[model samples]
Target chain A: MPWGKQETKPRLSPETIDYALAKAVADGDIVNLRQLFAPASPLRAWSPENIYSPKYAYLLPPSEQEGERLFQEALALVRDPDIAEHARAQLEKDGPPQLHAALVMTLADNAVRLGKFGAAAQAYEWLRVRPRMQEEFLRQGDTALDQNDIARAVAAYHAGTGLAYNYAAFPEPLPAVPDYQTRALILHADYPSTPENCVAMQDPAAFIRTALSYVFLDAETAARLDARPLEQRIAFTAAFVRRRDPDWDAFAERYRNTCTFVTAFGRRLAQDTPPAEAEDGGLAEEIEEQQATADPREIEARLLGRSIPEGEWWQYLKELAYEHPAAALFVARQSVGHGVEIVMPRLREDCPLVEPLGLDVTRTSRP
Target chain B: MNDAGYVDYFAALELTAEAKQGEVRKNYRKMMKDLLLSIGRERLTEEKRDRLLLDMARLNAAFYILRDNERRARYVEDRRRVIALEEEWRGLAETGGAGAEEARRQFDRAMRDFLTTYMEDLVLEAGRDRECVEASNWDRAHERHAGRVLRHDRHRHYQKILERLPFHEVTAPRVNWEERARVVDAILTEATR
Candidate 1:
C-alpha cells in the first residue's frame, strides 16, 4: 500500500495531501504529521512517481526538493509528544491495517525514551504479530546488529528474527552476592561480622555459587543450580576444581613466600607508620632494611596462628579451591604432609565423597 | 482485546470465542453487510478500494479460522501460553530475587516463540486464502523470510535499535539491562493490555 501504480484518479487532489503535509511540517504540527505518515494515510497512495507525474507536477518541488524539505521538517518534529500520543492512540485503537511497522517501531522507541513503557509495549506487541511486518522487523534487527547495539539488537532479533533468549543477552556478570542480607535470611544463617570477605568467606554455598557464576557457569546454568543442600553443593564444587597439579609444591612455595613477605611487611608498616603520615618514604625504607632480620616462620606463626574453629575454614577453603585451587591444595598438602603426590591422586581416583555435579562447566568457557 | 497477538476471530465477527459454526456463519453475514454498507458510503479510488478489501479479507480469514473446531481449539491453546507468560512475568517482578533475571529471560523466550509461531500461522493461512493473498500481495512461495532478508535488512534495523537504546556499545554484545528492561516493560504492558 505504501507504493503502487495509480490506475485511476485519486479521490482527493494531490494538492490536498501535499498541502496538509507542507502545513504540518512548517508548523511542526506533530498530530497532523502522525496522521499523514500513518500507513493508512491517503498520502501513501501517492508514490514518488505519482506525485511527480505530469498531472501533479504543479504540486511537486522542481525535482522533489519540496518533498525533501517536508521530510526534513517532519524529521525535526519526530520526538514531539503529540506524535507519541497519536502513536499511542493508534496502538490502543488496535486496527491491524492502519499500523505501519517502521512508524510504530519509531514511536515505540520514542515511548521508551520518554519512559512511557506502556505505549512502547503496545507497539512491540503490534509489530510482533503481523506477518507483513516480518521483513520490516528483521530489517530493524539487522540494522541494530550492524551498529553493534547489542541490547537493541537482541530486542529486535528476538521479536523479528526469532532469536532465542540466551545467556549471551546477559553479557555482564551479576553481583557476587546480589543482596547479602536476603540470602542470609533465605539460608537462615547469621550475617558475618567481619567485613573483609563477608559472605564469600563465611558461607561456602554462597561463595561457591558466586565463584562458579563469575568464572565457570553460563547465566542459564548458574541461574538454575540444583536444589541440593548447601554443604553438599560445596563439597561437589571443591572436588570439581581439585585437579592434581603437577607443580603443586613449587606453586605452594611461591605462595608461602608471597604470604610471608606480605604479612611481615604489613605488620612492620602498621607499627612504624602514623595513620595520617602512612606514605612517608623514609619510614618505609628503614622498615625494608629491618625486615631481613625478622624470622619468616615466626612472623607466619604470629599472623596465621590464631585458633580457627574447626569448620570455619571449611567453607572458605572450598571457595578458595574454586578460585585458586592451588591455595586449597597447598593447605591439603601441608595437612597430609610430604606424600601428597600419592595421596592426592589416590583421593581423586578412589574417593566417593562427592556425587557428580551433573553440569557442563565448559558451556561458556573459551575454547 | 488483542491478547498476545492472538487474532480474536470471534471478536472479528462480533461473536464470542465459544461461538459454534452456525453462529460464526450468522455473524459473518451480518458483519459483511455492515462492511459493505460502510464501503458503499465512501467514494474509493482503485488503490483505496483494494486497501479496504484487506479489511474484508481479514474478516473472512477470521471466519475461515474459527469455523473449524480444531483450529479454534489450537488458537486457544496457543494464546494460553502468552497469557501464562504474562502471569509468570508478573510473579517474577514481584518476587525480585535470584530468579528475577532467569524468569525475565524465560518470559522473553516464550513471548518471542509465541509471536513467531502466530505470525507463521497468519502467513500460512493468508497464503491459502485467495482474497487475502490478492489483497495483501503475499507470495507464499517466493516470500523472503527473515533468514534470507537478514543480510540486507540488518544494517537498517541496527540503526533503528541503536536510536532506541541510546549510548549502546557497537563492539560488544553486553546488554544495558536497564535500557533493555524499559523496552521489555513496555512489551509486557501491551501483552497484559
Candidate 2:
C-alpha cells in the first residue's frame, strides 16, 4: 500500500537441494553430504539439471538422482583412506536399486585400479546377473588375470560370454594363460609366482634385465640376451644359470649381480622405446609370429637331444618321472633288462636314474 | 537266437561302438536333455510313459557301462563271448543234428546267464563306490573319484578278442526283444548303483 519500493526475492526450487548438496561436497562436509544423499532423505529425490523431460526424452534418458549421488560418494570415498571402509560397508548394504548398482560399479573400477582383484571380482559377480554389465564381467576377468587367479578369470570370461550377445564379433579374443605356463610360473625358481613377473618375462628388455641379474651381468651378455627372443632367453637362463649352479652361494652371487643389472637396464630400455609403441604395438606381432610357427614337440625333442651332452639327461629324466613314470620305467628296464650290454653305456649314471624312474637301480642293474 | 543277449551299448546310446569318450558324453547329455524335456511336458499316455521310462533306464545303464574304461573293457569281453556263442549256436541250428534244438537252448541260456551276472556285478561295484563317496570321508572320496578317472585310460588288452568276434545278427521279433531288453535295463537301472 505504501508503494515505497518494489522488492524482489530469490525463489527456492526443487534443484536448490542439489545446489546445496554440491556446495556441501565442495566444502568437504562429508557427513552432511552423505545425509543429503541417504535413502530416506527428501534431498535424494532432487534430479540433476540436465534431466530429460517428456518432450526431449529421445535425447537421453533421465539420470537417476540417487545413482549420481552414490557415484559422487564413491569417488570421495576412494580418495580418503580413513573413510574407505565406510564406502565398502555402504556398498555391501542395500540401498536404492540404481544407487546400489552404481556404487558397485564404482567400487569395482576402483578395486581393479588398486590391484585388489578379489574385491573387484566380488563386485562384478554381483553385477553379473544385472542387465548391461557384460563388459564389467570381462574387466573382472582381466583383473583376475593380473592377480594370477586363473580359475576365477576363466569363470568370469565364461560368465561374460553367456551375457554378451555380440561377444564373438569383438575383434580381439580374451587372453588365455594356459595351464602348463601357469604351472611353470609356479614351479620355476627364477620366476617369481606373479602375473606381472610372467608378463615381464615376455618383454625382451625385461628378459635381458632378468638374465643379467640371474645369469651374466656384463653389458655384452645383456645385449646377447636382448638379441634372442624372450622365450629363448628365458629357457637359456633357466638351463644355464638356475640349474647349473649346484650350490646356493654361487647362485646368490649371480642373483645379486642380475638384480643390479636389471634396475639399470630396465630404465635404459624404457627411455629407448617410444611411449606409444611400448604401450601398444611393438614386439606383440613378432611374439605372435614366433608362437604361431613354434612346434612344442619339436622343441621338446631338441631339448632332449641337447641334454645328453650337458650330463643333464638324468635331471631331465627325473623331471619326466613325475609326469611319465611308465616311460621312465620302460627306459630303465631297457637299460638293465635282457639286453643290458646293448644299453648300459648309453644310459647316464651321474644320478641314480633308476631311483627317480621308481625302480631299484641295484636290482635293475643285474642281468 | 534273440538279440536280448547281444545288447550293444553303442547301439543303445545311438552311437557307433567306436565312438570316443567325448562323443559318448555328448550323446548321453543330448539324449538325457531330450528325454527330460519330453518327460517334463507331462503329455504322455501311461503306456508311452512306461516305454520312455524304460528307454531312459537303458540310456542310463549304457552310459554308465561305456563311460568307465574298466566296465567298458569287461562289457566288450562279454560282448565277444555272446558273439562266439551265437556263431556256434547258428552252426548247430543249421546242421540240424540230433538234439540240436536242446544244444542251442543250452547255449542261449548260458549266454543270457552270463549277461545277467555281469550286469549284476557292475551295479554292485558302482554301488560300493557310491557308498564310499556318500560316507563323506575326504580321502576315500578323493581316491574313489581318482580311481574312476584313472580307469578311463585302461589299456584295451581285449581288443584282439573284440576284433575276432563277428557282428551279432538279430533273429527275434524287433519289438519283443526290445521289450525284453527294456525290462532287463529297468532292473539294472533300479539297482542301488
Instruction: Please tell me which predicted candidate would have the highest DockQ against the true structure.
Output: 1
Candidate 1's displacement at residue A64, Å, is 40
Question: Which regions of candidate 1 deviate over 4 angstroms?
Answer: A1-367, B1-6, B45-54, B123-127, B130-193
Encode model 2's per-residue lDDT on A120-139: one tens digit a residue.
Answer: 44444344422234354545
* lDDT scores in order: 0.41, 0.39
Worst 10 residues of 1 chain A by lDDT: A337-346
Question: Which stretches of model 2 miss by more than 4 angstroms?
Answer: A1-367, B1-5, B97-106, B114-193
Residue A169 displacement in candidate 1 (angstroms)? 22
Error of 1 at A66 (Å): 40
DockQ for candidate 2, C-alpha atoms = 0.00
Candidate 1 lDDT, A1-367, residue by residue in tens: 3477545744555345545444444432334445555545445554333443465444323444445643444344433555444434443442322333334454544443333333444444434422323334445544544554444433443333221111112222111212222332223232222222233333445555753343222233333334545544455344333322233333333434434444444544223222233344444345445765643233222223222233233343343343343233222211111111000100122222212321222223221
In candidate 2, which residue pairs clash? Answer: A212-A258, A213-A258, A213-A259
Model 2's i-RMS, to one decimal, reads 29.8
lDDT tens digits, residues B134-169, model 2? 322223443333332222111111222223332221
RMSD of 1: 26.5
